[model samples]
Target: MKVKKQKRHRKSLTFYTACFGFRKPYKVLCDGTFVHHLVVNRITPADTALANILSATVKLYTTRCVLVELKRLGKSYSEAL
Candidate 1:
Protein backbone atom coordinates (compact mmCIF):
# COMPACT_ATOMS: atom_id res chain seq x y z
CA MET A 1 0.00 0.00 0.00
CA LYS A 2 2.72 2.41 0.96
CA VAL A 3 4.72 1.63 -2.16
CA LYS A 4 1.69 2.26 -4.32
CA LYS A 5 1.07 5.56 -2.60
CA GLN A 6 4.68 6.59 -3.09
CA LYS A 7 4.52 5.73 -6.77
CA ARG A 8 1.36 7.76 -7.15
CA HIS A 9 2.97 10.72 -5.45
CA ARG A 10 6.03 10.42 -7.68
CA LYS A 11 3.87 10.45 -10.79
CA SER A 12 1.96 13.51 -9.64
CA LEU A 13 5.13 15.33 -8.75
CA THR A 14 6.57 14.55 -12.14
CA PHE A 15 3.53 16.04 -13.78
CA TYR A 16 3.89 19.20 -11.73
CA THR A 17 7.55 19.53 -12.56
CA ALA A 18 7.01 18.91 -16.23
CA CYS A 19 3.93 21.03 -16.77
CA PHE A 20 3.93 23.58 -13.96
CA GLY A 21 7.69 23.91 -13.45
CA PHE A 22 7.70 23.26 -9.73
CA ARG A 23 11.18 23.10 -8.23
CA LYS A 24 12.72 21.28 -5.33
CA PRO A 25 12.53 22.36 -1.70
CA TYR A 26 8.83 22.57 -2.26
CA LYS A 27 6.88 25.34 -0.62
CA VAL A 28 3.79 24.26 1.33
CA LEU A 29 1.09 26.54 2.57
CA CYS A 30 -0.66 25.54 5.79
CA ASP A 31 -4.06 26.71 6.92
CA GLY A 32 -5.32 26.82 10.49
CA THR A 33 -7.06 23.47 10.11
CA PHE A 34 -3.98 21.75 8.76
CA VAL A 35 -1.85 23.16 11.56
CA HIS A 36 -4.37 22.02 14.11
CA HIS A 37 -4.47 18.57 12.55
CA LEU A 38 -0.68 18.31 12.72
CA VAL A 39 -0.62 19.38 16.32
CA VAL A 40 -3.47 17.10 17.33
CA ASN A 41 -1.91 14.17 15.54
CA ARG A 42 1.50 14.90 17.07
CA ILE A 43 3.12 15.35 13.70
CA THR A 44 6.06 17.30 14.96
CA PRO A 45 8.97 18.40 12.80
CA ALA A 46 6.49 19.32 10.10
CA ASP A 47 9.10 20.12 7.46
CA THR A 48 10.59 16.68 7.73
CA ALA A 49 7.20 15.00 7.56
CA LEU A 50 6.29 17.00 4.46
CA ALA A 51 9.67 16.34 2.91
CA ASN A 52 9.21 12.61 3.34
CA ILE A 53 5.87 12.77 1.57
CA LEU A 54 7.17 14.89 -1.31
CA SER A 55 10.46 12.99 -1.52
CA ALA A 56 12.21 16.38 -1.38
CA THR A 57 13.02 19.11 1.07
CA VAL A 58 10.21 21.48 1.99
CA LYS A 59 9.63 25.02 3.17
CA LEU A 60 6.50 25.58 5.23
CA TYR A 61 4.49 28.75 5.29
CA THR A 62 1.18 29.90 6.71
CA THR A 63 -0.77 33.05 6.08
CA ARG A 64 -1.29 35.84 8.58
CA CYS A 65 -5.00 35.13 8.49
CA VAL A 66 -4.37 31.52 9.36
CA LEU A 67 -2.24 32.53 12.29
CA VAL A 68 -4.85 34.96 13.48
CA GLU A 69 -7.51 32.30 13.29
CA LEU A 70 -5.40 29.84 15.19
CA LYS A 71 -4.82 32.50 17.84
CA ARG A 72 -8.49 33.22 18.01
CA LEU A 73 -9.12 29.53 18.73
CA GLY A 74 -7.24 30.15 21.95
CA LYS A 75 -5.13 27.98 24.30
CA SER A 76 -5.92 24.54 22.98
CA TYR A 77 -4.34 25.67 19.72
CA SER A 78 -1.60 27.77 21.25
CA GLU A 79 0.98 25.12 20.49
CA ALA A 80 0.08 25.43 16.84
CA LEU A 81 0.79 29.15 16.92
Candidate 2:
Protein backbone atom coordinates (compact mmCIF):
# COMPACT_ATOMS: atom_id res chain seq x y z
CA MET A 1 0.00 0.00 0.00
CA LYS A 2 2.81 2.38 0.84
CA VAL A 3 4.53 1.58 -2.44
CA LYS A 4 1.34 2.19 -4.38
CA LYS A 5 0.77 5.51 -2.65
CA GLN A 6 4.33 6.57 -3.38
CA LYS A 7 3.88 5.73 -7.04
CA ARG A 8 0.65 7.65 -7.19
CA HIS A 9 2.24 10.68 -5.55
CA ARG A 10 5.17 10.55 -7.94
CA LYS A 11 2.81 10.35 -10.89
CA SER A 12 0.85 13.28 -9.58
CA LEU A 13 4.02 15.28 -9.23
CA THR A 14 4.95 14.49 -12.81
CA PHE A 15 1.55 15.53 -14.09
CA TYR A 16 1.47 18.67 -11.97
CA THR A 17 4.92 19.69 -13.13
CA ALA A 18 4.03 19.13 -16.77
CA CYS A 19 0.96 21.25 -16.37
CA PHE A 20 3.09 24.00 -14.86
CA GLY A 21 6.67 24.85 -15.81
CA PHE A 22 8.46 24.55 -19.10
CA ARG A 23 12.00 23.21 -18.74
CA LYS A 24 15.21 24.42 -20.30
CA PRO A 25 18.90 24.28 -19.48
CA TYR A 26 18.92 27.85 -18.26
CA LYS A 27 15.45 28.48 -16.88
CA VAL A 28 11.86 27.47 -16.22
CA LEU A 29 8.60 29.45 -16.42
CA CYS A 30 5.97 29.73 -13.75
CA ASP A 31 3.23 30.13 -16.42
CA GLY A 32 1.41 32.59 -12.16
CA THR A 33 0.44 29.47 -10.23
CA PHE A 34 -0.13 27.21 -7.21
CA VAL A 35 2.56 28.56 -4.93
CA HIS A 36 1.44 32.02 -5.84
CA HIS A 37 -1.82 31.11 -4.23
CA LEU A 38 0.19 30.52 -1.07
CA VAL A 39 2.36 33.63 -1.15
CA VAL A 40 1.66 36.71 0.98
CA ASN A 41 3.09 40.24 0.60
CA ARG A 42 4.61 39.50 -2.77
CA ILE A 43 5.56 42.58 -4.76
CA THR A 44 5.37 43.19 -8.45
CA PRO A 45 8.32 44.65 -10.27
CA ALA A 46 8.72 48.40 -10.70
CA ASP A 47 7.08 48.04 -14.08
CA THR A 48 3.43 47.08 -13.69
CA ALA A 49 2.85 46.04 -17.31
CA LEU A 50 5.75 43.65 -17.29
CA ALA A 51 4.52 42.37 -13.96
CA ASN A 52 1.04 42.01 -15.36
CA ILE A 53 2.27 40.14 -18.37
CA LEU A 54 4.21 37.81 -16.17
CA SER A 55 1.23 37.42 -13.91
CA ALA A 56 -0.99 36.71 -16.89
CA THR A 57 1.29 34.33 -18.75
CA VAL A 58 3.11 32.67 -15.90
CA LYS A 59 1.19 29.99 -14.05
CA LEU A 60 2.30 28.47 -10.71
CA TYR A 61 5.72 28.14 -9.05
CA THR A 62 7.78 28.21 -5.87
CA THR A 63 11.07 29.87 -4.89
CA ARG A 64 12.30 27.54 -7.57
CA CYS A 65 10.66 29.97 -9.98
CA VAL A 66 12.93 32.74 -8.75
CA LEU A 67 15.93 30.51 -9.32
CA VAL A 68 14.85 29.91 -12.91
CA GLU A 69 14.18 33.62 -13.41
CA LEU A 70 17.66 34.45 -12.16
CA LYS A 71 19.12 31.97 -14.60
CA ARG A 72 17.02 33.36 -17.44
CA LEU A 73 18.29 36.86 -16.71
CA GLY A 74 21.85 35.48 -16.88
CA LYS A 75 22.16 35.53 -13.13
CA SER A 76 23.21 32.46 -11.13
CA TYR A 77 21.37 30.14 -8.76
CA SER A 78 23.03 26.79 -9.33
CA GLU A 79 23.65 26.40 -5.63
CA ALA A 80 19.95 26.98 -5.08
CA LEU A 81 19.17 24.40 -7.75
Candidate 3:
Protein backbone atom coordinates (compact mmCIF):
# COMPACT_ATOMS: atom_id res chain seq x y z
CA MET A 1 0.00 0.00 0.00
CA LYS A 2 1.30 3.41 -0.93
CA VAL A 3 0.56 6.35 1.32
CA LYS A 4 0.76 9.85 -0.08
CA LYS A 5 2.36 12.65 1.81
CA GLN A 6 0.33 15.80 2.14
CA LYS A 7 1.93 19.12 1.39
CA ARG A 8 1.96 21.71 4.10
CA HIS A 9 0.13 24.93 3.36
CA ARG A 10 1.69 28.28 4.01
CA LYS A 11 0.21 31.73 3.87
CA SER A 12 1.77 34.50 1.83
CA LEU A 13 3.23 37.60 3.45
CA THR A 14 0.57 39.70 1.80
CA PHE A 15 -2.05 37.77 3.72
CA TYR A 16 -0.35 38.54 7.02
CA THR A 17 0.17 42.15 6.04
CA ALA A 18 -3.54 42.51 5.34
CA CYS A 19 -4.42 40.72 8.56
CA PHE A 20 -2.16 43.11 10.48
CA GLY A 21 -3.81 46.08 8.76
CA PHE A 22 -0.65 47.74 7.47
CA ARG A 23 -1.48 50.93 5.64
CA LYS A 24 0.45 54.10 4.83
CA PRO A 25 3.90 54.20 6.42
CA TYR A 26 3.85 50.41 6.32
CA LYS A 27 5.87 48.00 8.35
CA VAL A 28 6.87 44.72 6.68
CA LEU A 29 8.00 41.56 8.38
CA CYS A 30 10.72 40.01 6.24
CA ASP A 31 11.08 36.25 6.14
CA GLY A 32 14.30 34.34 5.56
CA THR A 33 13.31 33.33 2.03
CA PHE A 34 12.87 36.96 1.03
CA VAL A 35 16.24 37.77 2.51
CA HIS A 36 17.80 34.84 0.65
CA HIS A 37 16.41 36.09 -2.64
CA LEU A 38 17.69 39.58 -1.95
CA VAL A 39 21.15 38.41 -0.99
CA VAL A 40 21.84 35.53 -3.34
CA ASN A 41 19.99 36.40 -6.51
CA ARG A 42 21.34 39.07 -8.81
CA ILE A 43 19.33 42.25 -8.74
CA THR A 44 16.15 41.81 -10.74
CA PRO A 45 13.25 44.11 -11.49
CA ALA A 46 11.25 42.59 -8.64
CA ASP A 47 14.13 43.10 -6.23
CA THR A 48 14.52 46.68 -7.33
CA ALA A 49 10.80 47.27 -6.92
CA LEU A 50 10.87 45.77 -3.47
CA ALA A 51 13.83 47.94 -2.50
CA ASN A 52 12.20 51.08 -3.85
CA ILE A 53 8.94 50.35 -2.04
CA LEU A 54 10.75 49.61 1.19
CA SER A 55 12.87 52.74 0.91
CA ALA A 56 9.92 54.92 0.08
CA THR A 57 7.20 53.69 2.42
CA VAL A 58 8.00 50.62 4.47
CA LYS A 59 9.94 49.65 7.54
CA LEU A 60 11.27 46.07 7.58
CA TYR A 61 11.56 43.70 10.50
CA THR A 62 12.63 40.12 11.18
CA THR A 63 12.07 37.73 14.07
CA ARG A 64 14.28 35.54 16.19
CA CYS A 65 12.89 32.58 14.26
CA VAL A 66 14.24 34.05 11.05
CA LEU A 67 17.61 34.71 12.68
CA VAL A 68 17.76 31.13 13.84
CA GLU A 69 16.99 29.88 10.34
CA LEU A 70 19.60 32.17 8.87
CA LYS A 71 22.15 30.86 11.36
CA ARG A 72 21.23 27.33 10.32
CA LEU A 73 21.76 28.33 6.71
CA GLY A 74 25.37 28.86 7.84
CA LYS A 75 28.05 31.56 7.89
CA SER A 76 28.30 32.09 4.15
CA TYR A 77 24.61 32.92 3.80
CA SER A 78 24.54 35.09 6.89
CA GLU A 79 27.71 36.92 5.88
CA ALA A 80 26.28 37.61 2.46
CA LEU A 81 23.76 39.87 4.20
Q: What are the lDDT figures for the candidates, one per model?
A: 0.85, 0.40, 0.58
TM-score of 3: 0.50
**Positional deviation of 56 in candidate 2, in angstroms?**
28
When summed lDDT is taken over every stretch of 10 residues in candidate 1, the lowest stretch is 72-81
Q: Which candidate is the best by lDDT?
A: 1
Model 2, position 44: C-alpha lDDT score:
38
**TM-score of candidate 2 relative to the true fold:** 0.26
List ranges where model 2 is wrong by over 4 Å: 22-81
TM-score of 1: 0.88
Looking at model 2, which ten-residue stretch has the lowest summed lDDT?
31-40
Colliding residue pairs in candidate 3: none
Q: Which candidate has the top score in TM-score? A: 1
lDDT of 1 by residue, 3-50 (tens): 999999999999999999999979999888888898889887888888
Candidate 1 vs candidate 3, lDDT winner: 1
Score candidate 3 by lDDT.
0.58
- For model 2, how does the per-residue alpha-carbon lDDT over 4-71 read when each residue is reduced to its tens digit? 76677557556755997633221333323322332322433213422343332323333766656545
Backbone clash numbers for all candidates listed: 0, 7, 0
Error of 2 at 10 (Å): 0.2
* Cα distance off (Å), candidate 1, residue 44: 0.7
In model 3, state the lDDT of residue 18.
75
Q: What does candidate 3's lDDT look like per residue over 1-81, in tens digits?
A: 112211111133356457976454555577888778866774344434554544335556778898889999877545533
